[model samples]
Target chain A: MKRERVTLRFSPDAYDKAITYHLVRDYGLVVNILRAEITPGQQGNLLLDLEGEPADITAALSYLSSEGIKVTPSERQIVIDKDSCVDCGACTAVCFSQALLIRAPEWDLAFDPDRCIACGLCLSACPVRAIHSKFSDPIEEAPPADEA
Target chain B: MATKTIAEINEKIRRGEAVVLTADQAAAMAKEQGVKAVAQQVDVVTTGTFGPMCSSGAFLNFGHSDPPIKMSRVHLNDVPAYAGIAAVDAYLGATELSDGRPEYGGAHVLEELLRGKAVRLRATAYGTDCYPRSQIESDIRLADINEAFLFNPRNAYQNYGAAVNSSSRTLRTYMGTLLPKFGNVNYSTSGCLSPLLNDPYLRTIGIGTKLFLGGAQGYVAWNGTQHNPSRPRNEHGIPVGGAATLSLIGDLKAMSPDFFRAAYFDGYGASLFLGVGIPIPVLDEDLARCVAVTDHDIQTTLFDYGVAERNRPSLGTYSYGELKSGQILLNGKKIRTAPLSSQKKALVIAKQLKGWIEQGDFLLSEAVAPLPQQATLHALNSKDEVK
Candidate 1:
């Protein structure tokens, strides 16, 4: 059994299909969607954690691919420009994940990326344009051409 | 023993023998060495603050051009400036926004001016004999200007209250974005390091007192706009929250951009994060003890911005140290806390002031008249029309 956090992008035609229902019934998987955006006959994106047998999850991905759906890993990180950041702590207020906080005594900002979900809400909250989102591109982040 | 005088301290500064410590250091030393001993040992206690000071502006005297005209209407870098004074003199407030962009304001213009950048100067007026011109638009740098002086009507608040949102909606405020429904908290004071907070009583800091103003030598010009000395205080004589403020004056050309940063509130207008440091000479043991105060000893009420009015409901009182904890327990819920003022910059200013006094480059002045101890701020009454 395995659990993986994945991002699924559905095309206009794929949006109408009951993929979530299929994952639960046919594949016997527990699909927990963290975030979702769907527009029937337009497009859709779902951030989900699929809990099922390793082989079954792989089969489900192939099924999604056959349905003209794209499967990708959800790997997002928040990057803060220390020099530009005035330490105003504007992002910390909207940070539901508690990744950004002020240090004690001196009152300096501290960022814990491990706790951050990379919700990207704080990006706009920052007045100085210091906070940013760094999405890991699997195509580029893969092993270098020479190393491979 | 005769009370120590500003002249006596100035003599020590002249001799390069003045002893100076930060407000926190003075208070800590007083706790250990006692106020009397510390007072006799230390010559000065420096106080500092780096916060978003909105009530600040600079009066610039633009050199007359080929076709001199009365600048009845003036704009500096697209930001409007008050030009009612003379043909070329204008007052650019810190929060006045540029016509193109609301976030860009006089603060940014002044900061650019400090960096020796040229600002757009535009004006319109009726032609006259001496100044016979209807319109004038030109680029002017700080050096091109005849004179520029910063006259902040209010800064260095004695002790300011903290703010929190208790209502169900997120409140966008100049206090930094307050989280909805008391989700978190925000404060705007440098606490123990603040000049007025240390003096609290306005004892040593007064008109004519020289200070480290925005990285240059300046003076306390007058009492700030809201000089509420009669406000409530704790047993230590320090006002509990929001009392005593100082109006300051300094040459804008002598100011540094490092001590001043332009701030744009998410919803509110532009404001300048001004850095000001004042050296308080310990004239007596009582004054020494007061300067020795710490963050734990000081307290300010938290206000809920949920109420849309001049008077907001007070949540509770918390010490600077307690508020610095990053989170506070209110109504059984842990509310996160944030600060708009920078203690890092405040510490740097305090250290810089201490070095200036040690180098004999800065001198402290005794308050000619202590700030009003009984003055109350009253709302203006409407005059009934006798028609």
Candidate 2:
């Protein structure tokens, strides 16, 4: 089984389609919605964790692209600047997923990107402005290829 | 009971025969070999804490300008500094926020200054006969300043309560963010390794007491603001909650940016993360017992920050042992716990202070006077308004 994390951005026009339902029923992919920001008639984004055969995941991605849904790999969503972090564990107060933690005995702050759901909560909790979210700003689609 | 004086310890230190240990090490040793035995074997016990201390700032003397001006209003990098004193002298408070940016404030400016970075200095003054220049703006580095000293009014709180939210909404506070329904618990102070907790009675820590402040030698100037030494204590004489505080003074020019840092809470404001360490002389069994406090022996109250008032509701009392275990039972539910204070850095400070004492480079000081053991907090009466 193959597991992957990806961000799905839906334009306003793609709001009516049942994206998650189609991915599960047609493509035979298991979808876990890590986070979602969807408002009716407005552009929305979903951070998802997909698990299935590699071929099935690829087919789902192609299907999403055909529906005009932008897919970006969610390889690293949270970035913590080690030089600025004081290991105070303030970010852990808001981190429900336990992605950011203070290791026992040593008391040093450790971050696990795999556990992070990209909630963007730690970005504000950091005192020295050390934590940042790549998805904090709205994802913008690439400009249409210039007509020849 | 074995006893040792500051002078005697200093003598041993100079002779390279003194035995120094961090509070953690000393506490463990005392636990294994009773207080009396440990007191006879150890010469000094050092304690340290690195946490958010909002009541901290620096006083700077920016030397005279070519055309001098009695700076009535001063700002360092847009954060206002109190310039009501001398011509070029000003005090920058850690909590002072900039006009445009709330996150960037006095603490950030202080950190920048310590990093040896040039900061924008702006001041305006009423024209005078001897100092005619009304306004001046320039970039100034820490090297350019004649003198810069940290004169914090309050720091190294003896013991503080853990904060939690019992309400339905999240609250942003200096204690860090608290989730609703006791979703998480946040506490500051280095517990067993905390300077004040180790010297709970203020015996070895008082006016003239030498200490490691932000990587520089500093002195206890006075009893810090809101210093309530009369706070209720446990069997060990340690306060159950926030109690005695210290007013510290140190040379900022010798401070390291590593120990002195700027911090910001999401919706709250800016504050300084200060590293403070104090060495306690093993005067006698009493002093030795005090410094032997451990996480299990020290107790702190958990306060509900959902109230949003000076007096918050207390959830319950728990030892540092339970809190540091990463979770505590509140209302029969397991609530995850986190610390706003950096325990790792506090240990580092304690170890550094121990090294200095072992090398005979740092010596203990006798307090000039004892801090008051009886003091009460007075609340402001809003009805008494001046006409």
Candidate 3:
């Protein structure tokens, strides 16, 4: 089994499409919506945690691409500027996922990207403005080259 | 009883024979060998704390321009500074916000200056006869300024309370974010390693005492504003809540960016994270006992920040040991606790101060005047009519 975190962006036209329904029914993938900001007529995005067989997950992503939904890897979504962070542990208070923590003995701040659900809570909790989101807005990727 | 004077300690330091220990090490040694034994062997106990201090600011004397302007209004990097002092002198407060930038403020400007970055300086004057210029604009770096010194009204709080929320909604405060229904507790103190906590009653730390400030030697100028010594104390004579702050001054030109930086809270405004260390000479067995205080002995009240009032409801008092353990039992619930102050940086600073004293590079100073012990705080009365 394979597990991957990804962001699925939907354009206004794709809002009516059943993206998660297709992933679970056709691709046999477990789709967990970590966060979502979808309105009926407006463009929105969903942060999802997908778990399934390697081939099934790949096929589900391909299906999403064909349906005009943009899929972005969640690896680079959250960035912590280590140089500016003082490791005061202020961000750990609001991080429910335990993604941000202060290591014991040394009291150094540690960030585990895998544990983060990208809830965007740590962005404001940081006192030095160190935590930031790279792709906060939905990026509209150019439509796949029309192949007749 | 083993007793020594600050002069004797300084002589030992000069001869490279003074025994110095960081507050944490001294506390452990005291636990092993007892306070009397440690008091006889140790000459100095160094303590440190790195935390956000909102009452910190810097005074800069910019050299006069070609045509001198009596700067009535001054802005540095778009952040307003108090320029009512002289022709080119201004005081930049840490909490002063930029015109539109909420995250950037005077603290950021000071940090950038320490990093050797140039800041834009713009000033306007009413055009005096002696100083004819009406307005001036220029770029100024730390090296270009005549003098830059830090004058903090309050720093190195002796003790502080932990904050928790009892209401249904989360509270965003200077104590960091407190979750609803006491989800988490937030505290800001260096515990046993804090300077004021080690000295407790201001026995060794007072006016004219030379100590480490932002990596530079600074002096305790006065009793800090809101220096309430009348706060209730535990059996060890330590305050149960926030008490006994210090007003400090130092040469900002000689400081390091590592020990000084700007901080912005989620909803709270800008503040400076200052690293301060104070050396407590083992002048007597009494002073030795104070420095030997450990996290297990130090206690503080946990107040509910959910109540939006000056006097919040106190939940209970807990030791720093329990707080540092990552979780504490509050009302039979295991609540996770977090610290706003950096214990790692505080330890590093304490070790650095110990190194300086052991190498005979830094000498202790006897306080010219001791801080008042009977000071009490009073709240402003809005209903009182002005005379």
Model 2 lDDT per residue over A54-145, tens place? 99999999888888777878756777889999999999989999998995689999888778899988888888889888654454773221
For model 3, name the residue pairs that clash: none
Off by over 4 Å in 3: A11-16, A39-43, A65-73, A135-148, B384-387
Chain B TM-score per candidate, please: 0.96, 0.98, 0.98
The lDDT per prediction is: 0.81, 0.90, 0.89
Candidate no. 3 TM-score: 0.94
Taking every candidate in turn, the Cα RMSD to the unseen true structure, in Å, is: 4.9, 2.8, 2.5
**What TM-score results for chain B when candidate 1 is compared with the true chain B?**
0.96
lDDT of 1 by residue, B3-92 (tens): 688889899999998889988788788788887877788888898888889999999998888878888999988999999998888999
Clashes of each: 2, 0, 0
On DockQ, the stronger of 1 and 2 is 2
Clash count (model 1, backbone only):
2
Q: Model 1, which residues run further than 4 Å from truth?
A: A1-77, A119-129, A133-148, B1-3, B380-387
Off by over 4 Å in 2: A9-22, A38-44, A58-75, A138-148, B384-387
- C-alpha positional error of residue B111 in candidate 2 after TM-score superposition, expressed in Å: 0.8
Error in Å for residue B221 of model 2: 0.5
